[model samples]
Target: MSLFWSIYVGVLVTSNLGLAIFLYIYGTRVKIPIEGDGTTGHSWDNGHLRESVRRLPRWWAMMSLTSIVVAIGYLILFPGFGNYKGLLGWTSEQQVSEARVANAQKLDQMFARYRQYPVNQLAGDSTARQYGNRLFQDNCAACHGTRAEGGHGFPALTVNGDDGDFVVSTALAGRTGVMPPWGAVLGEQGVTDVANYVLSLSGAPHDAARAQAGEPRFKETCAACHGAEGKGTKALGAPDLTDHSWIYGGDLASVEQSIRDGRTGHMPAWKDRLGEDQLRLIAAWLRYNALTEREASIAAPVADARR
Candidate 1:
């Protein structure tokens, strides 16, 4: 602290403590005159009640004195009185540093054991998944939903056929997908037609005539990134239209808007924020959830058939 602030704080502390001590001593010893009724003649409620002066209870006085002593001891031993370093020379920063070091050591031991198993195998371990779930919630849950079901602009982690390696790489390095604007190239009617054609590829409701008209244009333009089959290119982070998985809505208007104005999706790198082992844990949890969901999806139809 600056010398001025340090002295200011010291003076304030001394004054406050001195005032408290004076009050304690005076409260115990100072005499108050009482009328014959044993009241201090201070009336309240139109004299229905009168204030009474009694000695500070022995127990209360002792407790107050003890508290004052404890406060002094605390100030002497800790860094509460101005800029004084205290007798123990303890610091909150030092305490926090020690705690962080201890935590890091524990984490090192835990990750050491986890390193033995592949992420796919680690996904099966309940303890690893628990840790992974916490990591996912803390870091990944904002864009991807709690269940990884994703929102309008964000792609669903659950549906993507990304393995643990892909997930880890993408998370560590991040990825950006750009869909260039085709508005000028395609024109207004062309944009609409191409959108309908794109919808048709996904088996979504679209005008048949428009879809037919736009197919040639789609193949000529969009097929480069979207693939000839509209299945998408994983290397480029292009989304599969055929799977009916739309990062930006699958609706006619939404599709038209995307083709016209274009879209950009960015996944931020977690390399500095999260370590490789932590990322692997998250990837494992995501893989496990995806597999479980896929299995459930396959079994649902079988169960329905039995019914």
Candidate 2:
């Protein structure tokens, strides 16, 4: 606090303490004249009651003294006395720093062990998976879902995190999936036709006539990039439209909008944001989660025998 404010607070506290102490002592000892009826000259409740004055109880006086002593001691020993640090020399910042050091020390050993394993092997470990889950929940949960299902603009992390294709790209910094809005090039009608064609690539319900009409334009323009199957070139960070799984949305209207105005979403580059240790752990976690989902496909007897 400023000097003036500190002086003001000191004055107020002094005045309050002085008044309370005086009242406590004087109120108990002061004499009050009483009627012979053994009551003060006060009546209430239709004369059925009369006020009686009593000295403060010995226990109450002791309690009050104890509280005052504690307050004074606290003011002398703590920061309450106008920015005066306590004799104990404790501070919140110091406490937080100490806690962080302790936490880091504990994690140091874990990191050492983690660094020994390859990213692929680490993904299979139960302990690493647990730690990775917690780390992901803390850092990645905001953009990705709690379960990593994803939303309108966010990529589905359930598949992305675990799969080799996505994990490799996502790690060593992150990836930006940008489909620049093609609206200006296509105009309104051309945008709609191309969107239908994109949907047809996935076997999604679309207007065949419009998609056919868009084929020439698509081959000349979009095919150079989106590919003949619309399977998107990962080399360009282009999404596989044929999966019917959209980074934005899968509906006809949303698909049309993506082609019309395009979409740009950024998943932050993690190179500088996180330490190398964290990056490796996160990559392992992603692979672990994605591998589990592929079990059904690989569970077949014929597939197992081949493996």
Candidate 3:
């Protein structure tokens, strides 16, 4: 802290402590007027309520004194009064760093066996998956949902399950997917027609006449990236529009907005921060979770039939 702030804080703390001490001492010792029959002259409420004084309870006084002592001790041992640094020279930053080191040491022991196995082999281990899940929640849960279900513009991790190779590679090295804005190129009506046609690909509710008008424009303009069939190209990070899963949305309005405004998504690389092994672990966890979800979805109908 600056010199002025340090002095200001010190003064405030000291003044408060001093005032408390003064009050405690003065309150116990000060004498009050006592008329005959051991009552002060003060009276109220038709003389029913009369002011009376008594000595401070020994227990209460002791407790207050003890609290003052504890407060002084705390100030002496810890950094409470601005930048005093305290007698113990302890710091919150130092404590955090020490905790992190201890945690790393514990994790090193756990990950020792994992180091022996390659990422592909590690993907099958339950222990690795658990650790990977923790890492995912810590790092990737903000963009991707806690369950990896994806948010607004973020792509769901479970959509394309391919043993996690592609996801892991993408994680280690960041990738950017850009859908260039076409509002300027395509007029308002043209954008709406294209959106309707895009929605029609997935069998969503759309005007057939509008879709028919939009198909020719889509083939000429969007075919390069989205493909003529509108299934999209995975190699280019272009999403498959034919599927039910939509990143922005599958609705007419949302689709129109996407066409007009376009969208850009970025997945930052974690190689330098998380290392290759950690990335592999996270990828394995994602793959395992996706497979679990897929299996449950398939079993739901069978279970319902059996019931």
The candidate scoring highest on TM-score is: 1
After superposition, candidate 2 runs with Cα above 4 Å error: 35-38, 41-50, 109-112, 125-127, 164-174, 183-193, 209-220, 223-228, 233-235, 270-285, 293-307
Candidate 2 lDDT for residue 70: 86
lDDT string for model 1 (1-307, tens) is: 8899999999998998899899999999998999999998999999998998788899999998998899899889988778998999999999999999999999999999999888889889989989998999999899988988788889988876238888889999999999999999999999999999999997899999999999999999999999998988878988888865688999999999999999999999999999898999998899899888888877987999999
RMSD of 3: 5.2
Candidate 3 Cα misplacement greater than 4 A, ranges:
44-50, 117-131, 178-264, 272-278, 293-307
Query: Could you give candidate 2's per-residue lDDT for residues 1-307 as a string of tens digits?
Result: 8998888878887788788788777876789889888789799999899998777789998898888788878877776665577788777889999999999888787799888877789898888878878877888878877666677788766554655435645655667767777788888898778878888887889999998877777777787677877777766777767763677788889987888877787777766766677777777877777677556444765677998
lDDT: worst 10-residue window of model 3: 156-165
Better of 1 and 2 by TM-score: 1
What TM-score does structure 3 among the candidates reach?
Answer: 0.68
Clashes of each: 0, 2, 0
User: How well does model 1 score by local distance difference test?
Assistant: 0.90
Q: What shift in Å separates residue 52 of candidate 1 from its native position after superposition?
A: 7.1
* lDDT rank order: 1, 3, 2
